[model samples]
Target: MIYREYGQTGKKLSVVGFGGMRFGPDEDYGAQVVQRANSLGINYFDTAPFYCNDRSEDIFGKAFKNMPGQYYVSTKSNVGKESTADQVRWRIENSLKRMGIDKINFFHMWCIMDLNQYDRVMAKGGPYEGALKAKEEGLIDHLVFSTHCKGSDIRKIIEDDVFEGVLLGYNVVNHAFRQEGVQAALENKLGIVTMNPLGGGLIPQHQDYFSLLKEREDETVSQAALRFNAAQEGITVVLAGMGTIEEVEENVKIVDHPLTVSKEKVQEIRSKITESMDMLCTACGYCNKCPQKINIPTYMEAYNLSILKDDQETKHRLNWLREQEKIKEDDAKTDACVACGICEELCTQKLPIIERLKEMSLKY
Candidate 1:
């Protein structure tokens, strides 16, 4: 597996880091998996106190017995405004006891997804201060946060210059990083980590976002998805929670290969993807001036993409606006355009906005 820098510490960590959330009642099996992966050269192992209700860290410790100093162990604490210095320190001590390590390579502040979460951590009496104290006392090597919010929220956290690393959801599914603001974060040395690498196992169990590439896909779904992130600049590691030995072997093999999908292949995949898309609206934005002033492109794209999957989560979020009566449940689709003739007049493509929204309405 390729290695990359771990924050400013300059430690060359394996880009395919192992996530310990799956270490469960089968502690011995879990350890075996880690040992096999380590023997093959995966050095970064991440676990957190809250993962699987604290059993994961303990299992990680048991499974990697006597492997101290041979691998990097990363875990996080759920400490916050309510946590005192003593509480935070106690948690770290407990985590060390569970992981069988005196010092952690990366000690992240867990599950921070909003500005308020950051505020709570950076408060005068917050745990973020306690984390800094732990580093001073040699308990932790770095501080980080696993965020699941938009670029707007992430930017707020990066401005603090407080995090040694940033862990966020990055995958081929939601390419939020394509946005200019998200792109800026990569340009800076924030030490990015990708969570939900498989879109929460969508590629393995369900269909990959690039499933349209089946005609030309020379690699496995997981490999294609992983390479997508690893090829991107600023992503040091892509973490995967391997639950079984077979998964460990497959993932390690993928990482051992080149971390890229060829550009020509990428263009072809994009072509198939667009062609497979049932939405022909093309987001021409002819209806830029709506009386309700709804974000036509934003809502419509979300609506079109939602139909691609039968997954409950996708439907739940997609149905949110429709369920709220913003758009009629039946007529509620990106295709549900009244086409008031305003955006149509401005359309350079002369896309039939009203007709397209009408077609979209039929799909939902």
Candidate 2:
């Protein structure tokens, strides 16, 4: 496995870190996947409280018991969920207990959506203060943040000089969206870990559309997408959510091969990212806060089919979601959107969410 210094942290982390959010229902299988990644030299394992129905940390604890080598654990606390120092401290202890670890290698102020939320996290007795107290008590080794904020907003957060690292949603499709933040992290010598390197399965699911990312005939679109993120200038880790042993092994193979992709090829791919591609939703769920209680991400994900194919496909996708009960009866439909524009404001990709909702309203 290829390792890089996580900024100035003095610890060399595997370039392909294991994201623990995608584990299946079988916790034993999840534990096996974690152990396999560790055995293959994946030393950085990241989880959060509610990932995998709140079983993610417990799975990591299960795997850590018999881990063959050393590894680092990263977990998080949401400011909206646990806003105070005491609450955060209790969360830290709970995470430590769940993971069976003494000290958290990296603890994040989780999911800052904007500068306003960032300020809330950094308020005198808020989540950041709680993390700081945990760090002082040696419960957390490094204080980092995970965000869905824009690149400029990220630059502002980094300038505060409080976080030792950052976890942001970055991928081949939306690299330009977060480039400024990546550059700022590099400039400040802070650890940079990128999530959604596969666009949350968008790239892989539509491999024909993303075929431009592949440099070699043998490389799958998934590998090409992963390589694109790993080859970027400031990315310290290309975090992939590996659910099975096969996924773990495939991700690790990228590290075994050359990590470099020609800059011209990268630019070629970048230049081809159309307006529709830019609007494609990765289903990150930042827009789930709709006051109308609409399932924005689900609709946007269905909308992705319209971008890739046609409105008929989008309708079919929505039908499937409805049949599967992903869109519940109480959830507001697209027509219910009040043009309040909250989803667009919270969107990390800065997508034209209201416009798209109107389009969906008309079509369906």
Candidate 3:
């Protein structure tokens, strides 16, 4: 139930914020999870309509009926170039209705990946105007943005000075790449909420890579991730998408007395990880915008596990990789890569993707 100052906003938020993307099908179970989170002093809950095929908001609707104003609700607007201000306001109003809340504490422009998208949103008659209008009308308290852009582009987004805060991907493997953005947010006094603190499950998948984070005998890989992110200098909160009550309790325990790891220790861990594995995919999803839609991150994770962990774990990940849906434009497979080299260019870590794909193709 520990809290931290959310930048300079005068708001104290739970160090472990609830991400509403993974709520299960059981209504009562979801409600109890929310209730338990509330009892543990988790006040910040974030969701978007696209998450869980839009059922996540409905779960919140049921969970927040009598507990109004006891928590801070955060949601996003998914709009495009043709979207008007009314449409943006409608998105906000719809989220409010679904969550049974009067107003949202933070409303974000969701999934903005680059300056092109940012310009489109801020352009005339775009969703940005609609969000501003909603804020003026008291529907939303603050304006924010969520991005999956490269680390270099992240500071550019912050420099626009439009958003009060930002949500971006930051985890153990990608900390060095993301540190620039974190520093910029700190400079701007923006509230920094990091998503994928576990590298979108990559940390759990490669437990041996993050051994230095395990300070206590009872600590799990995920707990180490939560502590690592929570201890970062400018981070406001670390959001972990928990589907079950067990996940919630585990996260609560870690954040209740979150451990702080030193920079030297972190660098030593990174060095060891570098020595242990030939491929390093932080699962940032930057290279996921492939024309062929090859699911590079997932396969790369499986590949790393295959080399680092036991064969059974590797087989499990490979099976998981096989089950993932591919883009309809082409038959997606490891061997399907045309070697256009677009992914390599976009890759932050400069992974030898084509070579890896060639290697992985034999397994299929």
Q: Between prediction 1 and prediction 2, which has the larger lDDT?
A: 2
Worst 10 residues of 3 by lDDT: 321-330
The Cα error of candidate 3 at residue 209, in Å, is 4.4
Model 3 residue 219 CA deviation (Å) reads 1.5
Q: Per-residue CA lDDT of candidate 3, range 2-43, in tens?
A: 778876777888889999888878977887788778777789
> TM-score for each prediction?
0.73, 0.94, 0.87
Candidate 1 lDDT by residue in tens digits, 1-364:
6789865767888888888877656767877877777876789888887676657887778766855246888888764423666667777888888888789878877766457766777777577787789889898988877765557667777777788787776666544332332454565566777777765554555455556433334667777677777877778888888777887887787665677767776677555543344322234353466664655654544444454564354446557866777556454345435566765554322345566556545644
Q: Give stretches of model 2 more than 4 Å off.
A: 274-277, 319-333
> How would you encode candidate 2's per-residue C-alpha lDDT over 311-342 as one tens digit per residue?
89998988888889998777788899998988
Rank by TM-score, highest first.
2, 3, 1
Candidate 3 structure lDDT: 0.80
Write down the lDDT of every candidate, Cα atoms only: 0.67, 0.90, 0.80
| Cα error of candidate 2 at position 215, Å | 0.9
Model 1 score (lDDT): 0.67
